[model samples]
Target: MADKKPDSPSHEPPRGPILVPVDFSAHSEAALLLASDFADGLGCKLAVLHVVHDPQNMPGYYARMAGKKTLTRMADIAGEMLDEFMAKVQKRHPERHALHKAEVLLVKGIPVTRILQVVEKEKASMVVMGSKGATGLRHLLLGSVAEQVLGLAKLPVTIVKEQPKY
Candidate 1:
């Protein structure tokens, strides 16, 4: 009888970019770094997203009081900050060739909702974000965006937490 070859498993390439949401925090920076490495390894693009939470969406009197002009200005400032953040990332990871194809995205909306929207719109293969690891009242009030994303995202989600200081 002729020798038979064993069946080999297929290795499928990643379908879309890796999404990293940043809030200009150190934890977010760590997430960006980790996502960059993953993107390089997977030969996929990296998308750095920053969401400007709309003040108009705030509950109670504040939402009603916020004017359109003020909301516009806030969005503009957020865009500027996002640009600065991207610049810093570029400076820090100048040697990361994969980042050459990275896209910086700034959008206005609730953070978690906008993030999920972008993930679907961008067809992201995975989401990597930082968790502040908030606890107690702060966590209850603000809610954890990473946790929400992890629960809701259809694709893989990676939450990078800051290492504890000695």
Candidate 2:
């Protein structure tokens, strides 16, 4: 049922996978690790999703060289990054079986919109994501994804900060 994805529309709400949206930041890493524990404790699957967002001013994984610009396939780049990130997370916490068995999903769109959409489409039981805890003018202008998701998401959303390991 974990890999069945959107096809399983009739899936029970409480039995759906725990969705973890990762931005490859330290906070997101923490969220993934924590989500693994949640999944294990609940006996639910973990679905790790990465959104390939490209702003108007600068695209995702864009490189400018000698007045020439090159754009890598955002999906491709995001896929590789997501794979590497999952690997790193699993390596760091080898005991997290849920992390090792997480279902990987890649989608392209605005982070907040895509995330909420994924929640509905995948029928996620809950969302565990990281927040940078942005404040001041930056937060005013570019609100954190967590804040937007919190406001918009219909399901439970857990925002986690980076935890330092001793």
Candidate 3:
């Protein structure tokens, strides 16, 4: 019989950078919490990314107007939401002053593509995100960004699932 050796020690990647995609959901808050420890342990910087997918990207005359209005509203909301979220994070963890230097980004584009772009641009060692596990029609028609990123991202991804109790 072959003897089983002890499992190898798991090692976190060298302290580089962490990219966290936040949609201001509770699930995302959980991910950010996990990301905090990861950043602390790895001694890396954490950057929060918020992507605004243009709802109307069509090229027709009316479509152009629709796209403009939609994009503008989305940009406004994104900016406000990011500000609030950043304030909460700062309040939640004041000790991690280093992490406070994190960047809060708001970009408009396809979620997966934009996420990958930021990851590459930041040279992130890992990505932390939330998963709603959207089901049935929504899942079929509009796939979850987390799932898409999981499939396409080259970096390690940690998905935070929402819990019922909290």
Candidate 4:
């Protein structure tokens, strides 16, 4: 038998799917497109995630007063919205056939925490998300989910900024 080269690359399959967080914004569309490209190039799966922050978790006392029925209804609506959003994305980016294989997920919780949890749970190879690029008081008060994910994620994270139409 011929001796094999020690340094030859092994043809191992991709380790995990690429995770994309979509908030159904223009920025998120851009990120989704970028992720589609990555998934196609890497021959890996794609997972699209949308996190709906619970209104009951808001700081205001009134916001925190949501009952179980209200919370359940909200979650159901969010799930429907997520489904519609994914359908739109698929329709809009028909050329990106990799998106057809995407697994869409909807979860309720703090956005950043849920995102990270999904990444770990799914064994994602990388994360792609959009940044609204909020600044000043808004950034300080609301905080940026993309920024938090970038800081906390153990895997590679790509943040795509929305491009102006004009």
Residue by residue across 1-166, what tens digits does model 4's lDDT show? 9787899886765678999998778899889989999999888999999887865654332223234345556666666666877888889888887798899898878899999999999999999999989999978987799999999999999999987787
Ranking by TM-score: 2, 4, 1, 3
Per-model TM values vs. the true structure: 0.80, 0.83, 0.77, 0.80
Point out where model 4 deviates above 4 Å.
1-14, 56-72
CA lDDT of every candidate: 0.83, 0.84, 0.80, 0.84
Instruction: Return the number of clashes found in candidate 3.
Output: 0
Q: Could you give candidate 2's per-residue lDDT for residues 1-166 as a string of tens digits?
A: 3576676566343688899999888999989988899999888999999987875724434232212423555576668778888888888888999999999999988888999889988899999999889899988998888989999988899999999779
Model 4, poorest ten-residue lDDT window?
A: 59-68
lDDT tens readout by residue for model 1, 39-156 = 9888899999988785564533222223544554666766766777778877988988766678989887888999999999999999999998889997888779999999999999
Over 19-45, each residue of candidate 3 has an lDDT whose tens digit, in order, gives 889877789877887787888877888
User: Clashing pairs in model 4?
Assistant: none
At residue 118, give the lDDT of candidate 3. Answer: 94
Model 1 CA deviation exceeding 4 Å by range = 1-10, 56-72, 163-166
Any idea what lDDT model 2 has?
0.84
